[model samples]
Target: MLQSRRRLRSRIFVSFALFGLALTSLFAAATIYMRARLEDQLINNTLQREVENFVQFKQAHPEPDAPWKLSTFDAQIYSARKFANVPFAWQRYGTGVYDIRDFDENGKLRPYKLAVYKDDRYWAFLRLDVSTQRLSERQLITALGFAVLIFAGLSMLIGRWLSSRVMSPVSDLARRLRSLRRTGQFEPLAPNFADDEVGELAAALDDYAQRLTELVQRDREFNADVSHELRTPLAVIATTTELLLNAPDLSDKMRDRLKRMERASRQSTELIEALLLLSRAERSGPIDGETTDIARVCADVIDANRPHLGGRPVEVSLRVESPLAVNAPSSVVAVALNNLIGNAIKYTPQGEVVVRVQDGRVLVEDTGPGIKAEDAEKLFQRGVRGEGAVGKGAGLGLAIVRRLCELYGWGVGLRPREGGGAVATLDFQPRR
Candidate 1:
């Protein structure tokens, strides 16, 4: 549809230009013809009048060398006719009877003839010459050429402007589609006038994007639910394996073997769950859930991780001052916050870990060696490192938090703390 629109616009522009050129050519030809016809008629009328006047003048004077002041029209016309090879002749043979014959130098009949009568007898004859009106033709053609040039220029400008106006929306749509192809996203449909074809295209693209977003969202939900469902069985297997390792009758060698097996089982279970959550987060669309207090969620997370941070001399501070709330599932929010606090506790050995609420966001900060620039970007990926400074970690803590944030439709990011260590934040849009 878009390509067709562009082609249509291009054709319109070309057609307009061609129409203008045709119009100009027609007008130029008409102008030239009219000018030449008018000039010919004027010159013919002037020549006839000049010939009649000269005959009358000669009859009144009756002498070839007679001196008479000629009128402006007579002087101009006669001089031009003379230079163009007009002919004159006179003959007298009887009383008061004289015959005159006028012919061109090449014996060609002239365009004009005149006879002078004196004493009831013809005494002299005159014939005026004719020449092609090349000068008049050239002037008319030049004027017509100028007019056509102006018209063609104006037509080109108008055509280009109108074409761009019609095609601009199509260009924008093409750019958007290209961008989507590159990034694997079809979002942010542009608005256009309903009366235009571009509007129809925009509406269609918007609909397609909406359907795609919904399908992706469904997949994300399915993955998240699958991860949660798998956790229970994994927990059972891990617990059973631990029991076998702790059997009293078993030999030391058998016990050691069982312990390794138990450890491996636990790790595998966590890894699987983490992988599922990561898949969910990467695929999910915007989150839609109940409005829950984010501050309260942060407080619960801090409390849950307190036992793990107990032995260390690390100080923990929490400031959930405002009525911070978010539009998200409470369970997902809880899970996200728990992972955040747990990561902070695991990384910080002796310094403070603070949970604060401000500007409608929940921030968990820990004092430890900050994440390296190289690792920071991948910190939220599945099975990626959550706590860079912490030596013993499965690197799924931040991954879980990232997935939960996606499910809840909140923005999450990691940044270096002002003093030291790193701060993970969940910036949520407040419920109205």
Candidate 2:
């Protein structure tokens, strides 16, 4: 049911997003068209108003149509013309009057703007220039700008609303399901105020919760079955070891063999302990919220490994900024630093291992031969070895370190230090 709801949500989200995009495009195109029409109307109305004003002004003062010979007038029209011939674009042309010019598709005159004046009289004469290219372009640009801003704002609003309307219940249900996993209680579904896909999602999640409960019950039984099977062998091994050690009389060779057997048993126990620690480290969830000083953890790890240094001269440098803090468990951090320092000591024959905290990171540098490029990828894997590593200890130290950092969402990296040798760096987020 949860999977079905997820599929449904994906479809709804895509549809709503596409709807917003389509509306935005349509709005932009419509605004452009409207702006063009509005500019054309404005030009026409201005021409008519200007022409009427000129006519009214001419009537208030008297100007009789009489014979007038002007340089721009023809002989036949000059006797009837009463005003000077004026050239104004986008207006009608006649003798002793202003005219406008326009472009026409069929080779015919198209009036672009009005130029008004009375015949043989100067009465409030004015030219009204209309360049469709200029005014229309400005109007179109302004409308387009407004459309873009409005559509962008609306798109954001609609997109957010749709997402919440469609997916908020699914998100809530997922949280509830997670809660059920962490705790065994199966609480009733929360109220879904929405009446769309979100409501359906909430109902589907309730069904999912029921199935999860059944699966968990089966898993518990399975775990018990496996644990019972493994317990028999472990008990036999422990009992047999006790019997062997309790035996009193024994030859030197037999005692030595027994001693070796005990050593092997002890090593096995240590390996198991390490494995359990590693598993716990891997299963560890996100870091704890408590603030911890990483500098102190590094110091503790360095101090602990000092005994194992075998008198090999090793220099420890602590370059941490005072009070280095992070929201993590001190033990987890200590483990990571312990592994790094241990490796540094293990790999280096006899040299200083510089431990420094710089830029919110702990770096362990050793003068040992740096890891090869091919081996670097495999270094963090369990039981894997680089070119020069010796010994039979399972290579789980670095692997454990990596898993711990991953569980805590910290960063760990290895690189060759300048001059010689390799450097292992662990970057952790510092507390604000």
Candidate 3:
């Protein structure tokens, strides 16, 4: 978009420049042509008048033997045979009208309009010095050239100014849109803008923002209501399952089924809490004043999942280098970490799962048929499961983990372990 605007401004400037150039060039050419024509006419008229006056003076004086001298009308006379002092170019011309340029006695080039007259006795030639008129014409041409240059420069500046004025509102609109992304709030456009296309666009943007805000508000309210309503049934199921598991003389089969129900209920409650937190994070931000000990969280997650281990012969251990602390909601951290550890446990048929907290990262490593290269990234997407996935799942575990990480500015990644299986690492420093 920005590149397109720049091109638009450039096109406007070039158009103005070309227009100015063409107009100025046409005017300059016309001015120069008229000046040249007028100069020629004035010189020709002066030369003709001088030739007539010289002829009259000669006829009245009748001094054929007298030496040639400069005339009163800023001209010089020469006889046809007196070729000693005449210029070579003038001597070569026949008895016809001729315009010639030659150096004067002072070694400065000057224009001459020549006329020749023939009589029964001798031939008389008249030359008029038209250097002044030629100089004036040259000066006029130079001035016109300068005027064209000045006008062209001015046109360029005017084009630039006009483009800036035309694009100011658009640039402002773009800046406001960028700010809206950062702050999640719409800032009304200034009311003083001209009542034209830009003003209409600003009004349209404001209307869109209002409608979008209302839609987002409705969605947030709906998510909150749904999450709240789901908790009641989940709580009842969990409570009922716990009571059934503790019933005296309960059949083994019934107890096992109750345990599965309890686990499913717990998973549902966790998912609902995660969704609620995510919705809240979107509406406002990460919850404030919430912190968790990384080591304790990992230990609790591992212990909670031990019941599912049942006779899998998988060893789960937690290792903490120090008391690593994170400044984030415990539920957010728990959901992220539990997904990692739970996947590790669920995928590993008979190997060890190690949870380590070090260097501001929680590393969960497991020994299982390692993930396919293509599935490494796909695993984090909703409804995407790895090729080696074991248990039945909606494929929301890693997606939820990814969402929580993004909401709180944490980092999560999964990679294959060197020997075999996969390793998941969650970086918590960004949240802090």
Candidate 4:
């Protein structure tokens, strides 16, 4: 099964951070928009009212000008006969506020808002300078930018806090699971958590672990029972074969048959022991101050599998370029070598099967119909056979060999040989 590289806690934290940033950005933008809109409306309404009031005041006292009294604004009145006195830019506009920039008498640029109201006989203009308002707008923008930064920072801190709180139970569960793997103990997981999603997950894992523990226990007991029951009859056969071989009246052919029986019994016993170790997923180490002779085991396996040739002109040879001994059980070594040599013998029709032991590895090279490089690895899988496999077989021999090698921390692989054959290599780690 595949899993995510990123942790759930990290994803949650990032989601919260991004949401905070987006929310703050949106809020800041809306604030700026509303402030600008309301300011514009207020300024326009105040200017319009003032300009109208000035017109009404003029109309009420029509003798001397009410007062050329304008504090924040410059007011001007133009009669219909004095239309030319109105600024050409102001002459075209009617009865509304207009923002205008122009060169004044001092040859300097002046920006202002103009409020204009007109009738058939008179025109009223009110001008208000806006430099201070521009400065205020820039200040407001700067302030909002800082506010966005402050809130975004606060959001990040809050996200980290929430993630820690949310993931604490999950972290505890993981630590407990690691302890279980290291110590091989089972413990309930759900009771420590609240009634939440994490608690439900813990309950599910507890149930699965219990079922798996039971299944493994039963499998181990069955393997032990089978090994004990089968070893007794095999031990009897070995003893009987030795007794029958020692009889003085035994014929040469009868003695050879008894010797074959003894060899078969020994092979079966070794196979049983090796398989028991495999079933328990236990590695069988070498005895104290002793190591398994790889060359000797290869020779014995080659002799045992010669019968598989079925009278074909196949030559099986062993060459020890450099003697190798491994710190592992002889039976496991023997079982792994047997499959490699046996497969070579079965596949080679009329060629040579060379078993070479050197450099803490065994190389079985066979000159038969070679397998494709891609198909070599598949041959080690259970129930998988080569394209031109001969005779009846379950295709499990190589798979078992692979399992044994894996248990013992050894490496096994196959590749296409240069001279149209397959080369199987079983490399063992060097003993310390």
Identify the leading candidate in terms of lDDT: 4
In order, the Cα lDDT scores of the candidates are 0.65, 0.64, 0.76, 0.82
Model 4 C-alpha lDDT per residue in residues 163-218, reported as the tens digit of each score: 77557778888988899999987889877666666677889999999899899999
In order of lDDT, best first, we have: 4, 3, 1, 2
Any idea what lDDT model 2 has?
0.64
Worst lDDT 10-window in candidate 1:
72-81
Candidate 2 backbone collisions, by pair: 82-120, 83-120, 89-100, 89-101, 90-100, 90-101, 90-112, 90-113, 91-100
Model 2 bad stretches (over 4 Å): 1-163, 173-236, 273-377, 382-432
RMSD (Å) of each candidate, 1 decimal: 14.3, 12.1, 7.6, 7.3
Ranking by TM-score: 4, 3, 1, 2
Tell me the deviation in Å of residue 87 in model 4.
4.7
Q: What would the TM-scores of all predictions be?
A: 0.47, 0.40, 0.67, 0.77
State residue 24's C-alpha deviation in candidate 3, in Å: 6.8
**Which has the better lDDT: candidate 1, or candidate 3?**
3
Between candidates 2 and 4, which one is better according to TM-score?
A: 4
- The per-residue C-alpha lDDT of model 1 at residue 66 equals 90
Positional deviation of residue 193's Cα in model 3 after best superposition, in angstroms: 9.1
Which tens-of-lDDT digit does each residue in 1-432 have in candidate 2?
233334555768686878767886789678757866886777676666567755665677556763233211122222124324433331244434444554544576543444343355342333334454456668777877887787778778877877775665567767876887798777766353244465556667677766876886776676555445554555566567667767887677776666555544443443343344454444432254567788877776676666566677767566675457777656567667777887887777767788887767888899887776566658899888666777768888888877777777778878877777889988886353
Which candidate wins on TM-score? Answer: 4
